[model samples]
Target chain A: MSIRSLADDGATLVASGLTSLQRAHPDLVAISEEPAYVIRAGATPAKVALVSGGGSGHEPLHTGFVGMGMLDAAVPGAVFASPTAFDISTAIRAAHRDRGALLIVKNYTGDVLNFSIAAELAAEDGIATETVLVDDDVATDLQRVDGAGPSQPDSHRPGRRGTAAVIAVEKICGAAAEAGAGLAEVAALGRDVVHSSGTMALAFRACTHPGDDRPAFDLGDDEIEFGVGIHGERGVEVRPRAQAGELIAALTAPVQEGLGLGRGDAVIAIVNGLGAMTGLELSLAHHELDGYLGARGVTIARTLVGNYVTSLDMRGLSITLVRATDRFVELWDAPVRTPALTW
Target chain B: MSIRSLADDGATLVASGLTSLQRAHPDLVAISEEPAYVIRAGATPAKVALVSGGGSGHEPLHTGFVGMGMLDAAVPGAVFASPTAFDISTAIRAAHRDRGALLIVKNYTGDVLNFSIAAELAAEDGIATETVLVDDDVATDLQRVDGAGPSQPDSHRPGRRGTAAVIAVEKICGAAAEAGAGLAEVAALGRDVVHSSGTMALAFRACTHPGDDRPAFDLGDDEIEFGVGIHGERGVEVRPRAQAGELIAALTAPVQEGLGLGRGDAVIAIVNGLGAMTGLELSLAHHELDGYLGARGVTIARTLVGNYVTSLDMRGLSITLVRATDRFVELWDAPVRTPALTW
Candidate 1:
């Protein structure tokens, strides 16, 4: 039997979901449907506005994180598609204050292109904008050729596919902006977070699109799509299904190595559910990851465990580690009040 | 292919999960291994403590709700099982403060029996206690005789199975207790919330237990288990798959009628994901529910949309309506600091 979800259809999914999200958090977020974006509802103090968006289906990634102490606005496209540059530009114009705005874009071709164009569009209207590109997925980092020229075809080395680490980028950078950091300062902070983070994921089952009859991919009984991304796509390789410890290790060791984390290095860890993974499973992974890191003499300064970034309803999870400085830890602990994240 | 989850063997799932949970939210909660209960880590104000728990699958329910402005202690049983009376009494003793303790027990035979015995045990130790039984599920409301006698076997009429409404009860009552309500007053408030609440759930697919090859049940592609419970059991009836509005109406009308909700009646609405349901689906359901209620002239005073209570990874969602009084709304808006819920 095919997996099913309680969605009307793919075409209207994003609009309808935004309506509900705005209704559920009217005090926190407001929806603008003409250009299609969600902005903070209530008044915010004058600070650099934080705006981010990509595709829909990753609920709470951009929209759900729009509230006080987070994004000032979020532009959402249809399910798994990039928001139009016009939509992003309109949201930036509407959300930016005198301090201007910062655009946090995930490392995907369409997202980078659209967000960059929107930044220029906003700048034409006298709105100062800075972009922080998030490309923390270690899975896609393998194809990076040393000293590859900029002329190389984009497909050959797309850089790392951004994954769950965007949560860290958006959260920490949003905190900095909320603290009245200038646009350049906030962008610098976001880039620092992106630089310090790495993410890896695996899926036991693929996600089924809304109204579709079958999942995006299939897996054997004892196989896993290791190093999966956030678009219901298969992973870099197939691996035999093993114990939870081994699976978590496979995802975590690379992230730690990529960040050059060592004994006594503190980090902010995220055990993010792609979509269909349960809190029970995610918790087990975090516990195992904690034990693994502790054995490696690493200290987990803070942790977030939830479906922050999802790939529709894929049954898997990702591990993100951001090497945390005292400032990052302080900002991560800062108060935030969004629909998906709050403190 | 059989449904699979990223879990260890079934026997150690809860323990392993808790270790990770405590690791993730060390500042918010602490876990006791011997009795397997989670309690607020730091000192809480002297007041009537709120203690709750049930089987482990429905995470973020009792355990995840344990922290400030919510559950004081949560005694988790193994997956789909009940904690022993000894476990309940120990948690009660540890959680109770100078004011006493209040046991928030979901309406399951195992849960009721153990909590009742634990209350008595606590009384013997000079610890005053009260119990507020929650039976908000309308599915099992069938077969409940108007004036069933005490001698009637529970099997014949188990009444309603408590589901997602317990979140409102725990949250509202926990706030009251935190604000220094006595045990009797807190218990009375909890009972009022329970009496004012009703929940209905449906599943597109049944949940599979960890280490199990098959699911709890199966459904045809065009069928849904209407009025399903949180334990992954079949619903009260099988219904043809319909559009989102019709499915939502089917779930909401009964709940509205059961609560005697009419024009001008206000409510706190919840679109709770059973397990695998995505936030996209939940948001659409909430939007539909909101539209349905608005057309009927009822105002939704507050809204909560997420997987607050889940039945493992069941592909389903539940709707809960708690008739909102001003005091209930006030308490609902109170500050809370838990891992799963914070504001």
Candidate 2:
């Protein structure tokens, strides 16, 4: 249900969704409707305007945070697709009350390309712009495709793969913007948020987008797929489904090893829902995580387990680990007034 | 876990859970720590202190609402059982700070009996007390005996169910307190909230309390128990699992009929989670609801679908419909912050 696939009828539905959203949240939508869409609490322009958008389905990520502390304006795509270059440009234009705009994009090909084009358009309009791509998903970074689907020999690379890390970017960048940081500093911080926060997911089933007649990926009823994307894309591991705790352990093994988290090291762990898992399950997963980390001698000071970002109704859970330095924790604790991430 | 089922080892884990909850939310735990406690904001004595409680597993319900604008205090039982008479009586003592206390109990047999005893104790202490039973669940009121290790034919009755409608009482009651409404008026309003609210549930599985390792009732993997209660008690219809939309309609049917929702009717529908559904799934359910009501020619003015009340990790959902009048909507819009039900 990307913008590309959004036909006249679907656009009307999207319009209806937007209308419903605006009607339900007039004040929130009002903030987004501002001339320079970011409402920074005063007439004074923000030194750095953090503008971000990609898929439409990832809610409260950009739009919900468009207030005093977080993002300026969020351009939404239909579902999992990237927003048009025009919409991104329009959002940039609307948010850049200051001299520059900072764009945060996921590392997906369409999102990166679209944001780059938007930045170019913003530059033409004399608004300085910078872009940061979050690539923190272990599965994608280690992707080695051999001849047989995901079993390709070269399908294993070791690097950052992005998942729920964009949430961290929205939070940190939002706080940085509110703190009146400059464009360069905010852009750098946004990149760092992406650079630091990493996540990996395991799906019991694939997602079916709106009007999708079938699932995007096939998963046996007894088996689980590890490292699937938010779009229900296949992952690195398609092994037999293990016990819930063992499943979490397998997902965390690569993440913990990659982060080099030692004994007594404190980190911020997020147990995110791909879509279908309940908060209770997420909390249970967190309970298991506490034991898992304890068995590994790791210390976790702050944790959040909920459906922050989703992959349309996919039945899966992701383990996101953000190395919580003092500053990162401060950013995390900063007040946010989003529709979803309220505190 | 129930207090009875807790062996020394399991009791330790349960205690640890409470400890974690207390540490994470001190103000929230203040209501629970006292076993039964009262918290008043204003210096002036109120007419009736509002008190509510049930089991420990349902977070934010009885405990989360304790604050200036909500419940004076809430008593906690172990898991899904009723609070002890002593605990309820103690809470009354703590809450009877010159004003009387009103005990709001859901229509659970144990809760009714326990709170009634507590009320008698409070009256003996010269603290006047009133009790109101919330029987909002449209589902069967009693447990079904499979083979019945013990036959209790009189207990399990049909047409008794409850859900998040209790949240409305905390809300309206809080407003009543703010408006300095008298005890009679508040009591009447509390009853009105129940009268206006109708709830029905669909369980994916059964609920098991402490001491009962087995579910009160069991369903096959492909089964969906309609008209289920919070306690994982048996439901009315044990139908095979269907699509989420169909399941929601099944639950909403009783609610719509009870509320007498008509075409062009404006209503506030809360697609509440029984225990385990994620917020995202609830939102998706809301989306379905909007479509359902739209097709039915009903106009939904406000929708608050979330895990307002839960039944441990029971995988189920309940739909609570409060036939919306403009006044209730305003009351809902009224801002009052508390531990869980913050505006």
What is each candidate's DockQ, to 2 decimals? Answer: 0.68, 0.13
* C-alpha TM-scores of all predictions: 0.96, 0.75
- Identify the leading candidate in terms of lDDT: 1
Cα lDDT tens digits for candidate 2, B1-343: 1211111132233333443333334443353454544344335255568888876566547766776667776777766668889988988787665557777888877888899999898888898777767878866533343432225454555235455788877777767765677677778777877888888877765554534545567667567777777876666666765565676676687778877887978877777765444333455567667777788888877766556787754657777777777767777777655645555
How much is the lDDT of residue A42 in candidate 2? 39
Q: Whole-model lDDT for model 1 versus the true structure?
A: 0.87
Best by TM-score: 1
Q: Which parts of model 1 are misplaced by more than 4 Å?
A: A143-155, B143-155
RMSD list, candidates in order: 3.3, 6.8
Per-residue accuracy of model 1 over A1-343 as CA lDDT, tens digit each: 5666676497567878889888778889999988999999977789999999999988878899998778999999888999999999999988988898999999899999999999899989999998999999887754323333245666776787888888998889888888888988998999999999999998988888898888888888888887778887566677877888888888798899989999989999999988888778988888889889999999999999889999888899999999999999988988888989998
